[model samples]
Target: MTGKERRARIVELLEGAQAPVSGTALARELGVSRQVIVQDVALLRADGTAVVSTSRGYSLARDARPCRLLKEHHRDDEVADEMYLIVDMGGTIEDTMVNHRTYGQMSAHLGVSSRRDVERFLDDLRSSRSSLLSGITSGYHFHHVRADSEETLDAIEQALREHGWLVPMSDYEREALR
Candidate 1:
């Protein structure tokens, strides 16, 4: 199939998928190498397909929802706890971002919406040599959280505050985000 056709197939697969689909799986199904699938995904993203890559694999971005960018700080060990709290409060952790003095902003798609997702993320972290993105910023980071309604986001924010994880954004961050 042509590159264009392959990309369209990729989008179709992502849209219909119940969970994140791995590049390897897509490559095998499409009779191409994983690198080709990766390149296809990159091209697809450049074209504004909203493909999200998570620890498990790739998926399409969800429909419009109330989202909040929350600044938080915590120890590495508390990662699971924070994630669990957010998911339990009916929030989806869309992504995690950190601002570095040199790097400006760095982020990753989390797609963590359930307890299973949280456990899978932790497992991936534990099995890999890499560490959390927040580590580079000394545990200070921002989570892009989405929920069905503003009330759910408010509840998640309150829970984070109660856990002493929510933090005030710096003036620079506030301006930069805007």
Candidate 2:
């Protein structure tokens, strides 16, 4: 099949999928190299197809309606604490976004769907010796979450705040939540 046809299929798959689709899986389905899949996805995005790329893979950007902001503050060290908060509230960390005081906004694609995903993500970071987004921010980070209700999202925010993993919206006031 042609690249265009493959991309269309990918978009269809992403639209129907309940979770992010991995690059390897997409490559396998299309009988193409993973790099080619990546390039195709990029091209699709460039054409404004609403395909949001996350660290886990690709997901179609289709929020049901009524835009909601799920805000939370968390110290970097308290990742597990925040993860529990999300899991308990029937929410998952959709993405991790950061704003460097110097570098503007930086984001990492973390499609953390479960506790195991969180653990694997952390383990990968450790094994790869990757650098944290901001060294100065005292373990502070933000999560874009998807949940059934606003209350659940608020509960996550509250839990993160209680654990001191959450940073206040003031000071630098960088929005960690989205």
Candidate 3:
């Protein structure tokens, strides 16, 4: 199929998908290379399509949620607890961001919303030899969380604070939460 036709097909396929669609799967179905699918996806986003790339793959962006940036600190071993606390309080851990003296700001997608998701994320990090961003900044970092409501977010903040994970939001970091 032509490139335009292929992209149309991609939108159709993703529209009904129950889960994120992998680029490899899309490429195979469209008889194109994965790189081409990636480019096509980029072009789609450039055209204002709401496709989000998750760890699993690509899925259409859902309606925006009420999200907040929370600063937290903990040891490496306490990572799972922090994640669990947020998810258990009806918060979806959208992503994590950290500022580096050298790299400026760095971020990564987490998409963690459950204990299982936290476990998987922890396992992947351990098995991949990747270090947490918090490690770079003395256990200080931020999480963008989508909660069911402001009450839920308040509860999450309380829990994090009670557990001694809440860090004071700095003036430099406050603006970025928006």
* Tens digit of per-residue lDDT, candidate 3, span 1-178: 7776787799899998999999999999988899999998875653334588998889988745677788888999999888988888789987777777786666677789999999999999999999998899998888878877888998999889999999998786674333
| Each prediction's whole-model lDDT (CA) | 0.87, 0.66, 0.82
Spell out the clash pairs found in candidate 1.
none
Q: lDDT winner between 1 and 2, please give it.
A: 1
Q: Candidate 1 or 3, higher lDDT? A: 1
How well does each candidate superpose onto the true structure, as a TM-score?
Answer: 0.66, 0.56, 0.66
TM-score of 1: 0.66
Clash statistics: count for each candidate = 0, 8, 0
Candidate 3 deviant stretches above 4 angstroms: 1-60
Q: Which candidate is the best by lDDT?
A: 1
Per-residue alpha-carbon lDDT of model 1 for 8-115, expressed as tens digits? 899889888999999999999899999999988875653435688998999998666877889999999899999999999999887788889998776677889999
Q: Residue 93 CA error for candidate 2 (Å)?
A: 0.8
